[model samples]
Target: MSAAPSLPVRALAALGRPVIAAARATLELWGVLIGTLAGIIRSYGKGGRRPRGAVVAQMYAIGNRSLVFVAVTLGFIGMVMMYQACLQFSRAIGDLSQVGLQFLRLVVSDFGPTLTAMMLATRVGAGIAAEIGSMKVTEQLDALRMSGVLPIDYLLVPRFLASIVMTVALTILGAAIMYGAGGLTAWLSFGVNPRTFFDPAMVQPRHLALGLVKAVTYGAAIPIVSGFCGLRARGSSEGVGWATTAAVVGSSFAVIALDFALSVGALWLFGGDL
Candidate 1:
């Protein structure tokens, strides 16, 4: 028989188990994300088949369904931003119009994309995970394969594209509503005219483009992360539920992490003065 481990060895082994498991999980997740991206690229290739209906449907679900939710949440976020910043900007600049200038810069540069992605992670990411996890647990994925339907193409590709397109569009819409809300809040609460609270010139093209880039990056990532968790789910309904939770948590973390990275990159690449 092998010699029993010493206390130090036992402790190290115990620590190693969790660390190894987390490393494996992370590697598997990266593989899944890369494979999903490859599948999308293949579908766009001449040798591959593209699925249009699935893409459209997912766009409707991720984009159209999210409109009201994004609108309401972002609208309030803008008002809150105005309430906090109006006093500071007005007092400093002695011009409430400066509030609008500052608001646009802050919202477009950071808050707009980050908040939208986080909200979507909880809602759309969770739903995608649960739905696909249930299918995985039920052997539906195998059935699709048996029927000659590639799950990556029919399921993941559509979601990937839809999320990017819809997220970008929805982010624009939400930002519009948020600006309106900020203006209204500034006018009524701070006695700043709504018109003066808006100056399109204060926002640079880079700011707007970077915001969309962030949104698109997050949009594409959520599906890959959620679908990875879902496709790997096993065991009972409890397992599926856990997978759903994992998807949301993982996607949310990714959204925040990516936002930070992208924000820094944007600043470095474009040199955002604001």
Candidate 2:
């Protein structure tokens, strides 16, 4: 009979554990959000050390290491789009001569940049979150603060700058490869000449503009998502794993969501062909 009272106590404890956990998660998320914002502000305000060298180092790490991954992924993306489009177009329309045009219209305006961005997000966003989260867990962030170094200026700003640059550059490369490489394959497969593939009149300035926009949006998304997750990391190896997964998933969703918004805006502002 006494066990009945003990059961209720245990039940309450179990329920209370979950509620406390939920509160803690909410607090952690908010803390990270706030901390990231503060970091951004601090990055902008940093002026010491006669212009810090840390930004350069960070740029090298974030931008340079990421370039090869972006390029290789985008190259394969180009091949896939070309191969798929060729298959579909040949079956339906027999307009193989228009392959370059088709590639430009679809890949340049949308898929190439978006896919490339998502790939970069997967590679870089998770990495950043894990690296930073691990750093935070190990107290490296605190060590930086103790040394009187503004961590954001030294850490986050470089990542922000590098990611934006990398995204834009990689997107441009991806679009080119998709259009150029895809066009070449189309030409070779269907007996079309090189002139059809290289003609400048086939490309649209508006689509190019849209590609750049996608790249910039993607660039902005990766670091912010990564930084957010990194800041939010707490407890155990499981927490680091969770943060990495969240960073990748969150950044991917943000990239896709932003791409859609950009596509719509581009289409509306620049016309349907965009």
Candidate 3:
């Protein structure tokens, strides 16, 4: 066997300590999320009834409360997308219908799902983390455990289920808002008729399915990352701040990365049908 490392080697090893710790923490977080998922699934099958009120409250919190912001943001996105598409198409065909068709594909398949997810990650993910982290720092999590409540089952599951459902719902809602706003923008800004700005045929079922896939994955990622960071938090207010920040950052990165992967995969499989 080789001898032990020298002092220099040990000193150099410290350089990698942070990286290794981060990697380990990431892996541990994923493990916790996986366990949480399994717990939710197990609870759903033969498990006792979950708190329906909690789930409903979560849905309302995650879904209904987010509509105004989603609407305004997506509406602006739609207008911008329409303006750009019109500018490009006007130089070529000058056909509003064609412009509308292309816009629909680009927005519904990619931007709609991706941007909405990022927005949700920024807002909802941070909120989840802050709340959970505060609870953690306050010893509320331990109290729940002492009270015979499975925290994962009682807390994470409802959030997960609600997030998945709401993100999917919001994707569809945002798409509609975007399309409508784009159509109007096209008409007002580009002389394209409103009637010609929206073509139902442009939105294929494949696009719908792809959007849903993005929504679900992004949705799951946000709450999982956020809740995990929050639950693991220590210290005091600073810890909660760090957890919230981490949730937003991690969820944002996950959304973008997942969007790219899904886009590439779908393109490979469907040859742009997606």
The candidate maximizing lDDT is 1
For all candidates in order, the CA lDDT equals: 0.86, 0.74, 0.86
Give the residue spans of candidate 1 off by over 4 A: 88-95, 272-274
lDDT of 2 by residue, 1-95 (tens): 35455788889998999999879866865565456456657656665332236556656666677667767776777767777777887789976
lDDT of 2: 0.74
Candidate 2 vs candidate 3: the TM-score winner is 3
lDDT, candidate 3, 51-105, per-residue tens: 6788889989998999888889999988887888888888887666687787788
TM-score of each: 0.94, 0.79, 0.92
The TM-score that candidate 1 achieves is 0.94
Residue 259 displacement in candidate 2 (angstroms): 0.5
Per residue, candidate 1 scores C-alpha lDDT tens digits across 5-109 of 999999999999999999999898888777778888888898887878889999999999999999999999989888888877767876676778878877786
